[model samples]
Target: MIFRQIKLPPMLGYLLIGMAIGPHALGVIPSSEEASHLAEFGVVFLMFTLGLEFNLAKLSAMRHIVLGLGLAQVLSMLALVGSAALLLGLSWQVGLALGAAMAMSSTAMVSKLLTDRNELQTPHGQNAFGILLFQDLAVVPFLIMIPVLGQPAEQLTSSLGFAALKIIVVLTLLLWLGQKLMRPWFNLVARQHSSELFMLNILLITLGIAWLTELAGLSLALGAFLAGMLIAETEYRYQVEDDIRPFRDLLLGLFFVIVGMNLNFAILLDQWPLICVLVLILGPIKVMIITALARLFGNSAGAAWRTGFALGQGGEFAFVLLALAAGEQIIPPAINQSTVAAIIVSMLITPFLIQHSDKLVLRLASSEWMNLATNLHQIAVRSMANTGHVILCGYGRSGQSLGRILHSEHINFFALDLDPEKVREAGAAGESVVYGDAAKREVLIAAGLMRARALIVTYAETHSAMKILEMVHQIRPELPVIVRTQDDSDIDLLKNAGAAEVVAEIMEGSLMLASHTMMLLGVPLNKVVRRIREVREARYQLIRGFYRGTHEESDESDRQQPRLHSVQLTQNAHAIGYQIGELGLNELHIEVRSIRRKNQPSIQPDEQFQLQNGDVIVLLGVPENLAAAEMLLLQGNR
Candidate 1:
């Protein structure tokens, strides 16, 4: 709450609270050692989740930034920061330790901030994430090198060579084992229909892998990360993320608390001047280096500065490295304390730098240094001049179909997408499409959002679709917006979110199928069109009634109308244990017409069927009766 009030990131708040309540201060949590042991899982869980969010497809898409620019940033930071530490009279090992630590930027912090600001897909934000991802992947080797750095001259080469060979063998074995066992193991656990069991299985997977990795002379965190990556390849990734999130968050908070407790106030007070000097020097120097690297990789100056400022901090990993170095006697307590203080201070300032990145660019970069590419800017400006055109917010199948129809009808339309390949291909064929993210207000404006007749979102990501809705409403509230969804469940949500219309492909495709069948039965074209329109109108009216809270009775019917109710099963909900027949939905006059599990539908399912968590039951009944059914679903067997 304090951080929220001050508009600071929660990470800083966690750090502050930990510091204030810690042994060095109030002594509420006097034993930092105890906290550290407990908080270690925070890193383990964090790495696990990071791996779970892995996308082979997305990683491929971001290969250049994640691998190329990311590699460049890490190597450069290690060289520069390590050199600086050496200049400060630190031993080579100590310098290397500090360098490796400082080379990482906070993935969680930067990604969270950029996501909140709706900039994660912007050129800068993407670049920053890519670099952070690489840094995360780099942690494994860095951990291996830590003990090597602590070794004497005689054992250095042997230690390095042995570590390399061990890493290769471990990685290959982990991958092979994961491919053989991961999906099958999870599938068996899922069939048990117990959320607790599912969660436990996940914990086992995480800790088991972590244990294996530690046993193989690698970090426990790396093992957890590999577990997550293996899971990411399967179909259960989203559910795993949802199920494990609470544990991850609580442990992560504890981790931050441990970090805060590690701050030595006595050392900080004694080395205040040095700490200040280092923070000041490090922030700007890191920014310059990161900015230069970003620009070298084709990011414009604006994007480069934004990326630099967003990541101008010694990251969370720095604390881990310093603690390890201190333990290994690679760095003295005094140097460790000072480096920790400097790192924390830098972290404290990163949010401020990112928040005011625009002003920073304006202040530091000259007009010419803004580095706006002439052709892209001119093209964007020209696109912005378009009026009364439809703005299509995706370039996939649905969007392309819409565009073709618009073209055939000689209607003005412009499509925007972040997929450079799609935009390039379409533009080569003289299509009015451009590369841009619609979730960015600037990008929307550049796509002529203000003067557009309508906005259509065909993106599959619900979060992205919702974000675009909010952005569009903020800019043009009255503009017509039609959003496409994979299921009917999001229809009411999308509409409530300010989408003028929500098109669920499943429902519409069914309607299309029915229409084709009718035509095949010798129905006239005009009659078929009229029937389709009537069906659409009826669905829209029902949706309108649902949103307006007027489903008790219809004006035309003058009686309670049967309304569609979708009840999603939450963990341990009342309906989960009982079979449909046993629950007695019939008592509430709620007919269970169908059930949707994992995108597959079971129409008029067996009455004796038990429901799993996440099952969406389709009910048709009067409003008050459906409400009772919903209440039962939510209330569970209690």
Candidate 2:
């Protein structure tokens, strides 16, 4: 049953199952060092995938939040824990170890949860990701500090500094060389079109880089993450991700299972009172403090609570640090064991806490302080909203071109894009672009759909587009909507769902085909398909004007406009060997539009024209005069 649902999140179930079979219960899997080794692979692959998805541009843009907020959280948590450990009369080294362990949050678990809930693109998610990024980076520094901080300072300082220097050198070299070299290598591999070879190369690169980082005294996970970032820049990134995902998932699943198997119920039972205190008292207190700090940094009340709730559990990395410190005799075996039990329990309860965070926040918001916070956040959002706008969903090629045109026309438009980097870049350029999912009503609301004059959905999967249209109709039925779809089959559905205009993809493709086919079939070069396009545009405009009640039935001025006209060439033609200008065609009240040769429009034509057999002349004039010109031009050609 569990294997059948492998695609589902197996972590929670695995944890519960592990608890049932752990040492104090059925004793199926012992609390052995081998269990720890098995669990480490999960961490490795989790880090590898995280690296694969890491967007360097976004990291650069959010560096302040990543560095500042992340560092503050770490330092503040460390300070509070260090004080508590001292109050408990633990040794200074043990105090430091405990502080370091408690300072971190579970990047793997939180990210997985966020991804599952589809909250990873939200503002809070970005902030949480930034913090996690810094924490991942902090692993190197923490490893260096462990040996020195746990031991007598005088003896370990020089070694610690040397280790730190080596790590810095390796990281710098990897970032520089990886960014410069990996893309071309991947591109070369991609051209070979061997899936097995590509998969092999991806594994080698991920493991090789992780080993290199480990050899440099940094975590293997960090190295794998960096390798992923390098590959992310390659054109073959998606393929690489697809190839490596199975291995990553299997290893990560094994890792979580091992983490669960490590639950030593005996130790947990011995320290049940302390463990409960940590889970109940310390957990909520830590969350509250973190929430307050996050709010201070301008996060919404909801965002702050989410940030706090997500970090409530002690991180997986904390166990790593604690184990390392225990080996160094810095923290006692009992303290380490108790901390592990407390961490596991906290982690097991965390998902439920986060799942219920919305209700928790809503209840909290009923309070005076929270109400004030919510009001302040609402004010900030309102102040950011500017008017006279068009909201464009999707920023793909066509959408981008439209945005440029809108900019040139000095139109006020805001773009909503799923791609975070594009959204960030567009915003940086002083465009009102937002990172959001167009399919979701909340995301649409965030993009100011209600305030806009028009909504344009330029790029989306069909289902997503349909959902957006449905949401638009439900929210503001009268709002003008334009949608672009790649299939003609969706046109009727889009229209029925309240799209004012559906630019069918097939229509555009057919038009392109017709123009190219005519050119290939020897359409006159001077006009070719231009006159056809113009007439179509004019007809469309006329129809639109009529629909808008702007074109009256009595309007003769529109009727006087020239229409598209064409005639087939015949064996006899009086105009043969005569230049179009010399033919006195204007006196005949006729205009040459194009000429078709060999059953096709000749793209190249000359004013000094000679009629040929099977050539077709297209003309524009009054209906009667055009007939006269057609008869004269085709008299001899046929």
Candidate 3:
């Protein structure tokens, strides 16, 4: 909360929390051992997720920035910074450690800050992210080398060569495993119809791969990265990202807090002059190197400087290198303590630098550069337009699938996605995809919403979907809107918000299962189709009164019932393996109108019927009872 007035990054605030409660300060978390141990998993999960996001196709597209500029930035900063440290009276090993630490920049901080500023799609922002991508991948080798650097001088040559070979071998093996093993395994997990199993599989792949790399004498981060890359090649990349993000972020915060606990306030004060000197030395050197690399690689002067400002901070990896160096005795404890303070302080100032980048760069480049950027944005807007085209929000798997179908039928549609990498790849492949948030009315208009044939929202996340729906209603009320949802729980909410068609994934999957079963049982295809349509027609009104806002009346012609809910039972749900008659639904004040299991629908399922996991129970009750019933069903008599 104090960060609100300070205007510092939340990460820095997290660090402060750690520092204040740490052994060195309040002694609230006196030992710090357990916290640090748990926090180690944070680095593991983070690297795993990073690997998942490292789409080979996307990186290959930004090859110049990723390989050329990113490589240059790291190498140059390391070389120059290392040389400077050597001249400053440090041993070669310590100098190398110092240089490696200085070469790093925070991916999480820079990307997130740029996104908040809505500059992620801008040239400079993309350049910054691309450079960060390389830095992230480079950390594996850095991790490998750090330990080797700590070894005796006689062993350095052989260890270095072995490390290089392992990196190549590990990467090649990951590629092979991704193609031959990971894909099939994930497919099996997905087919199990168990969300828990699916999530478990995700965890296994992540931590298991991370462990494999650690066993191979490489960093756990490297293994996790490879695992993520393997998953990225599959259709489940985004879902995997969503499933693991909360765990990753939580553990990552723990990791950062541990890092903060290492910062002794007394030491920081005692070495204030030295800390300030190091920060002053590191920030500009890193920035100048990055800016020079960006400009040399064809970025405009303003863009180059903006890129510099975005990445000026010493990254989280700097802390990793510093800690390892200290532990290995490659760098003196005093040096690590002071250098860590400098790195933390550098990170502390990055957000301010990024927020004020344009203002800072304007002083460096004339106003004409800004004008040119504006013209480019205008050109981009013009290119996104095509009258009568459908406006497709989100270009993830669902959106891309929809676009392909639309294209097959010769329907013009432009894709809008927030992921810049996806946007760049789509654009390169001659797909009509725009990089922007579709939840914004301006972004919608830019995609030619007014002249569009219809709107299809394939984005995940209910809140953003609702916002897009509301905006669409406000802009052109008559435009047919179809939205995809993860489940039936939000159907009524979306329907009430003016969605013409709300596809509930769980219910639809159940319907498909039922339909296929009927056909195999000698039922005619026409009969199967009619039955499936009838099921949708039955609960077509979706959930109503579940949310207060959903109680609003719709002016649309169709007046469907609003209080029905289709809730699915997860594997570990409390009510799983219990019968409807046993649960005493009447006492709970809820009614199970129907139940869907395997490939069959039971209308007003018999009280004697047993409940299994993954049963889609259609409940009808008042909002309060429905909520209680859902809780009861999932929790099993709790």
lDDT of 1: 0.78
| TM-scores, one per candidate | 0.68, 0.57, 0.60
**Ten-residue segment with the worst summed lDDT in candidate 1?**
541-550
Misplaced by over 4 Å in model 1 are 1-8, 53-63, 165-191, 215-217, 229-238, 362-387, 390-411, 416-418, 435-638
Candidate 3 yields a Cα-based lDDT of 0.77
Q: Which ten residues in a row have the lowest lDDT in candidate 3?
A: 541-550
Better of 1 and 3 by TM-score: 1
* lDDT agreement of model 2 with the native: 0.69
Model 2: per-residue Cα lDDT over 141-207, one tens digit each: 6766776665466767677777778777987899898888888888788789898888889888988
- Counting clashing residue pairs in each candidate, in order, gives 2, 21, 6
Model 1, 1-638: lDDT tens digits are 88776656677778788889887888887855666877889878888988887777877988999899989988897888678778878777877887788787787678877876656666787888888888887876777789668789899899889888988998899899888898898899989999999989999999999999889877788788889999998899999999889998888888878777767788789988878766865698888989999989887777888889988888777776776677678988777777777877887787787877876786766652334344347447768667889898888888999999998977888888766667889999998988766766767877788788788887656667888988876666546578888888877677667665678888889999999999999998878877777777677633423332323545765437676656678777877877898888888887886665542423348888888877767677888888888888879422
Best by lDDT: 1
In the predicted model 1, the residue pairs found to clash are 574-636, 574-637
Instruction: State each model's CA lDDT, in order.
Output: 0.78, 0.69, 0.77
